[model samples]
Target chain A: MNHLDEKDIRKLTEETVKQLGSSATPELVENVVKEAIDRIQYKAGSHVIDTSPLKKAALQQSGNRIIVTAFGKNRVGILAGLTGILARHKCNILDLTQKLLQEFFTIMILVDINESPVDFDTIKTDVTRVGEELDLKVVIQHEEIFNAMHRV
Target chain B: MPIAIEEILETIRMTEVEHFDIRTVTMGISLKDCCSDDLNKLKKNIYEKIMRVAAEHVMVAKKIESDYGISIANKRIAVTPISLIADAYHKEDFIEIAQTLDKAAHELGIDFLGGFSALVQKGATPGEQNMMHAVPDALASTQHICSSVNVATTKAGINMDAVKLMGEVIKQTAQLTGDKDAIGCAKLVVFANVPEDNPFIAGAFHGVSEPDVVINVGISGPGVILRTIREIPDTLDISTLSDHIRRMAFKITRAGEYLGKKVAEMQNVQFGIVDISLAPTPVPGDSVADILKAIGLEDVGAAGTTAALALLNDSVKRGGMMASSYVGGMSGAFIPVSEDEGMIRAAERGNISIEKLEAMTSVCSVGLDMIAIPGKTSAEIISGIIADECAIGISNNKTTAVRIIPVPGKDVGESVNYGGLLGMAPIMGCSQLSNNIFINRGGRFPAPVKGINN
Candidate 1:
C-alpha cells in the first residue's frame, strides 16, 4: 500500500502476514494491500490531508459580530447563495460551518459587519426575511446573548 | 471566551419563540417646577416641559434598540402627580391639563402618559380633592393619559374617604367610556404604597425624591423563567428550583440594566432603576399563572399556588436584585388577569376567583390587576376590594394596587376586550354582599402598629 503512510503500511503489512500465516496467497496479499490503501485514504485525520481547510483562523476573524444560523432541506446552492448575500452586504465571514445529513441542511456563520457601513436594520431585515429570499429558516443574533447566558 | 454561539442562539430563541422582551423604557419627567397659580400658564408650562424632556425619547429609544438587538415593547412617560401642582386649579378645569398631557404624549409618539395622579393616604387637601374629582373626566378625555390614586401606605394608613371617592370615580369613568369596553378604567389604577420609579403604567409617576429627568426600565420575563423551570428535572426540591429561577433572573435583569443605562447615557438623563417585574402579555406562552401551574398546581388558584408564587417571587428578587445596582419599583411577579393568557383561561374555567386572586396578591406583586367585574357591581364593593388590598399592603409593608374595570352593561361570563396588551377578559363575579355601611363611615384605617420588638 504505497498510498498508506509508512506507519500504517508497515502495521497493515505485518498484520496481514501474521493473521493469514502459511495460507497467505498472492491474491490475499494483493487484496490486503488494496483494502489498506482504501481505508487509509477514507479515514479521519489522514496523513496527507490538507488541514488548512479546517483551521478557522486561516480565513476568519472575530469582532463586533452577528451569527447567522440557517436550516432547511438539503439542496444545491444553499451555502453559496447565503454566503453570496452576506458578501454582497459587505459582511465579512468570520467562521462558517455547514453539514448535510438525512436531506437536512444546517448552517451557521459568524460574521463581522463593522466594515460593512450598512445599517444594522438592513442586515437584520435581510436575515429575518431570508426565507423569502432563499427558502430557508434563518435567525440573526448578537453576541451579547451568549455572553449574558453562559458567562458571569 | 466572552460568549458562545450557543448562548446567543438561546437568547434569540427566548425572544423569538417564548415572547421575552423589555416591557418599557419610561422617562420620568418631574413637573414640580411647572406649578403655577395661573391655570393657563400651568397648562402651557406642563406641555412645554414634557415636550422639551421627551422630544427625542422615541427617536433615541429606537436608535438604542437597533444598537442592541432586543426590542423595547413600550416607550412611556411618567410625570409628577398633578395634585401636588394643581392646588389652585378648580376641579372642573383639570380636563384641560389632561388634554395637554395627551397632546404632548401623542406628539412624542409615547404610548402611555402616567401621573395624572393624587396621593391622599393621610388626608386630601383642596388640590388633591380637585385632582381626585377630575379622575373620570381626565381619563375619559385622553387616550394616552393614565391616572392613579394612592390611598394607603404602611406609614400613613388607609384613607377611607379617598378610597370611597375612587370607587365612584372608577364607576363614572367606566360609564363615560362604556361604549369602548370601559377602557378608561383600564387606564386608571388605585394603589397602596405605590412605587415612585415604577416604569409600568398605570401606576408610574415621578416622585419628589427623583431627579428632574430620569430613565427607568422594566423587564418582562415570565416566559423566560417558565421555559427555564420546564428544563429542570422534576425530582428537584424547592431550593434547587429557586436557584434555577434566580440564575435566569440575573441574566434578564442584566439585559434590562444594560439597555436602561445605554438609553440614559445617550439622552444625558440619570438612570433611575430596573423594575424586575415579570409582566405578562396577552400573547400565548407569556403567563405567570402558567409558571404556577408548571410548579405542580392543578390550576393557578388551586391550593399551594401562593406557596409556589412566593418561592418564585423570592428567587426572582434575589437574583434580579443582585444583577442591578439600584433595583426598585414592583420587583416581583404581577398577576394581571386580562394580560396573561393562562390567567384568562383559569378565570374562564372557574378555577380562579376574586377571593383566590386576593390570596395570591398577598404573596404576589401588584393587586387585582387587569380584572373586570360585572357592570352592576356597586362602587361600594369595589371600595371594599381596594380596602382589603390596602390592608394587606399596610400590614406587610409591600406595594399593592387595584386596576379593576367594571364594564358598563356587561354581565358575568361575557368578555370585555380592550385590544392590544390591555387584552380581553371574562367579566368576573364579585360578591352581592355589600359593605356599604362600613365603607360609608368616613375615617382612616389606622396603620398597624408593627413594633413588637420595641
Candidate 2:
C-alpha cells in the first residue's frame, strides 16, 4: 500500500480546484481534500488481509444484549470479577473496551443476557453489586446491537 | 466567505442592547397538604412548605442567569388552588392561608405568589365556597397574592352560579382595593379551560401530574418579532410577511427550547413545557399591539388587524410547534391591555373598543385579558363577558380567560397608570342593557356542540 504525503495532497487539492474553477468554494475544497487523505490513510494503515472472517464471527453471536458503561479507576481483576458475576448468571460477554483518562479508567461492556430467565433488574443489581465490591461505578443499559446495525 | 462572524455577534449583541428580559420566573407549588382545622397550624404548615420549596429558587435562578448570561425576570411561586388546600378548613383559614402565602413570598423575595384560587367549573366545593366568601377581604389584605377561579371547562360546562359569585367578588375586590389604584382585582383572573402548568403569575398553579419539583420556562420575544416585521419592505405581500414571522418564531422557539432544557438540567428537575406565548411588558417597544401596528395597522383595532393577527397567531404556533416537541400552555400572542403600552394608547384614543378586543381574542391568544372596565358596569354585564369568553374557549377547544378590573371613578377615555409592569389603561365601558334575567337563571351552559359525542 502507498500513502500520500502532505505535498502530494496539496497538489491534488490545487488540481481539483483548477478543474472546478471558481465554482468550488474554499470550504468545499478543504472538505474534499480532507476526505481523500482520510481514505488513503485508512487503506495504508490496514494490516488485515481478510475482513470476512471477522464479520462471520460477529454475525454468529446475534442475541439479546446489554451495554454497561462504567466510569472509575482501573484495577486488577476488574474485568474478571465483572465477567465472573455475569457468567454465574449465565450471561455471555460479547465485546468490551477500556480507556484510561489520566489515572481513572472507563469500561464499556456488551453482554448477552438471553440464556438466563432473570430479568434486566436482576442482572443490573448483580453487576452493580460486583462494581461496588471492585470500587467502580457501573450503569447497565439495554441495547440490541444486531437489530440496530442491520435493521436500521 | 459567509456572513462575517463579527456581524453574527453584532446581531446577537443587538438583541440584548435594549432587551428587557422577562419580568419574573414564577414556580407553581402545590399546597395540598396544608389543610388543617387549626388555623394557626395551617398557616405554619403553609409557610414552612413554601419556604422549604422556594428557599433556593432565587439563589439557583440567579446563579444560572449569571452563568448562562440569560436574565430571569422574576422569581415567584404559585401553589395548588388554596381552596383545595383548605378543603377541611373554614373561611378564616382561607384568609390565614392567603396571608401566610403572601408573607412567605415576601420573605422569599418573590414579586407575586399565585394559586389563591378556586376551581368551581362543575360546582363550588365547600372549601371553594368559603374561599369565595373571603376573597374580598383576603385580596384587600394581601399585598403580593394573586387569585383565580376556573368556572368553566369543555367537559364540565360553565357554572352560572360560580360566575355570578365571581362577578360580585370581582366588584368587591375592586371596591376594597380601589384606593390602591384597583391593584387588588388587577391580580385576580377569571378563567375557563385554564391550564395546570402555566408559569405566568396570577394564574399559575401546580398541576397534578407535575413532579415534586420542576422548572417551566415561558419564552417571550415580541420585541424580536416586532423588529423583524419592521425591517420588511411594504411592497411585499402578506404571505411573505407571514413567512418571515414564522421563521423568526422558529428561531426564537429554538433558543427557548435550548435554554429550557439547560435550565431544567441545571435545576435537576423535569423539563416542563415551553409557554411560547409572546408575553409583552410595559416597556415602550415591547408590546404585542406594537407588533400588530408594525404590520401596517394604525392601532390594534384598525381594519384588517384581526386578519393580520390571525395570520400571526397561526404562523407563530406552526413555527413553535415545529421547534419544540412539548409545546403547551398559552402558546400565542398575549394582548393584555394594561400590560402593553401600545394597547393602553389604543384604548385611550378610542381606537380599540371592547367589542373589537373581544373579536381579536377569537383569533389571537387569551381572551379579554387585563382589561379595565368602568366600576358602574353591572355584575350581570361582567357575567356576560365571562360567558362570551368562555363560550369562545368551549367552542374552539382552547384556553380563554378574562382579568377585567372595574376601575372606580374611571370611565371611557380616562386612563389610569398602575405603574411598572402593570402599565396603564383607559377604562372601557360595558353595555348598560340589563342581562340580570339571563345571568340569574343560574344554570349550567351545556358543553358546546363540539364537546358532545352521541
Candidate 3:
C-alpha cells in the first residue's frame, strides 16, 4: 500500500483539529492520519503486466469507473494481494475503505481503469480470482448503476 | 464516497435479497408495413421484420445485466395488432401468421411475443371478427404466441357481441389445451381500455401512434417495498409510511429508467417508457399481496386490503412519475393469484374470493388475472363476469382485464398447476347464477357518463 506523505497528513490533521476544536488530541490526530492513508492509495506500481488475449478486448466502460466490494474473514496480506493485481493492470485507486469487525473484514474500493489497457471484464475476473485466493467474497459493478439509483 | 455508503448498500441489498429487477425489456415492432394481399408474402414479411429488429434484443439485455449488475427477468416482443394487417386475410391466414410469430420468437430466444390481437371495443370489422375466431387455434397451436382482444373501452363502452364471442373463444382455447391444465387460457386476455405501450404481457402491443421500433421496460419491486414497509415503525402515521414507499419507488424507477435508456442506446432504438408496475413472482418474498399484508392487513382479503392497495399503487406512481420523464402502461400493483405466493396462500385458505378480487381490481391494476374456475361454468356466466369487470373500468376510466381460465373437468376443490412463472392456481368458485337472458340480449352496453355521475 502507498502511504500518504507527511505534508498531506499535516493538512488533514489541521482541518480535523479545526473541526474538533478543543476536543482534538494527539491520539485523534493519529487516527485521522491513519484513516486518510487507508482512504487513498496511489502511485504504487510503475511496471505493467505483459499483454494477454484479455487485454485486446475492451469492456464497455461506463464512465471508466468500477466499484469493488469484498467481505470475509480478516487475515494478513489480503489488501496487498488485492491491490497488487490492480497495480499490475495499471488501474488507479480513486478511494478505498477497509474495516475489521470482530473476526470479519469488509472493503469497498472505487477504482478507475481509464489508464489501464485491460478490458473491464478481464480486470473484474482477475480481481474476483484474487479474492477467491484470499478467501473473500467479492463483487464488482460499474459506477453508473450506483449513480443512477442514489443520485438525481 | 461520491455515493453514500448506506445508499450503495441499499441498492446491493435490493438486487441481491429483495428480488428487485427489470421485469422485462420488450421490443415493440410495428407489423403494419408487413401487410399483404398475398398470404405467403405477409407471413414471410412479418417473420423477417421481427427477426431483423429483435436480433440484438436478448444480446443487449444480457450485456447490460452483467455490466450494471442488475438482472433483467424477461426479454419479450410485441407487435402491432394483427387485425389491422389481417383484414385482407382469413382465419387460416391469421393462424399461419401466429405460427410464424411463434417461430420467429423461438428463433430469437424470446419467451413471449404479444399482439396476436384484435381491437373491437365498439364493433368488429369482418376481418377483425375472423381474427377473433382464430384466437383459440392460434394460441393452442403456437408455443410462445399470446393473444388479447379489446372488447370494451371508456369511449366505446362494452361491445357485448364481441364479449360474447370472446367467451366462446376462451372456452375453446381451454378445451384445446386441456392436456396442459387449460394453459391456453393463461395466454389470452380480454381487456377494457388496454394501454398500447404496456410492456407486460399478454397485454403488450405496439400502439398505432408509437414509433416504428421502440423499447419499453417493465420495472418490478414488490419485495423492496415490502422490506421498506417492514422497516418502518408502526407508531408512525400512514402519511409518513407513504413517504417512505415513495422514496423507495423513486430509487427503483430511476434504476429502471437508466437501464432502459442504456439498452435502447446500445440497440440503436428509441426508448419508449418505464412501466413501474409492482409485478410479483412465485417466489415468497417478491409478492404484492405480502406488501398489502405488511401494510397492516391480516391477509390480502381483509377488510382494509383495497384501501391499503390503493395507497401503495398511488405512492408508487407518484414516485415513479418524478423519476422518469416518460411513464406509461399499466403502472399499478398487480395482484395475480397464481403468480404471487402470498395470494396463492390467501386463496388456498379461502381468505380471498373472486368477488373480493373484483372489488380490489377497482383500485389495483389489472382485473381477474390468472384466476381458475370450475369447468362446469357456463359461457354466459363468463360473459357476465367480463361485463361486470368492463363496467368498472369504463366507469373509472382505468385499464382492466380478465385472464380467467375455466379448467376443463376441474372443480372448486381441485387446483391447476402449470409450473414456472404461471404458478399454481387453486380453483376458486364463481357465482353459479345465470345471466343468459341478459347476455343473449346483447348489442352494446353503451358508454358511461364521463363526469358528475356519482
Tell me the interface RMSD of every candidate, in Å: 4.8, 17.0, 7.0
Q: What would the per-residue lDDT of candidate 2 be over residues B349-391, giving only the tens digit for each residue?
A: 8888889988888887688888889888877888888888888
Which TM-score value belongs to model 3?
A: 0.90
Q: Please, what are the lDDT tens digits per residue for candidate 3 over residues B168-253?
A: 89899999999998999999999999999999989998888889999999999999999999998878889998999999999999
Total clashing pairs in model 3: 0
| Residue B381 lDDT (model 2) | 86
Stretches > 4 Å off in candidate 2? A1-152, B1-11, B18-24
Docking class of 2: incorrect
Single out the weakest 10-residue window by summed lDDT for candidate 1 chain B. Answer: B1-10
Q: Across residues B149-261, which tens digit of lDDT does each residue of candidate 1 receive?
A: 99999888999999999999999999999989899999999999999999999999999789999999999988999999999888889899999999989988988988888
Per-residue alpha-carbon lDDT of model 2 for A57-82, expressed as tens digits?
33345566666656668889888888
TM-score of 1: 0.86
Query: Which window of 10 residues has the lowest lDDT sum in candidate 2 chain A?
Result: A143-152
Candidate that would win on lDDT: 3
> Could you tell me which 10 consecutive residues in candidate 3 chain B have the lowest summed lDDT?
B1-10
What residue runs in model 1 are displaced by over 4 Å at the alpha carbon?
Answer: A1-63, A88-90, A96-106, A125-132, B451-454
List the candidate numbers ranked by TM-score, top first.
Answer: 3, 1, 2
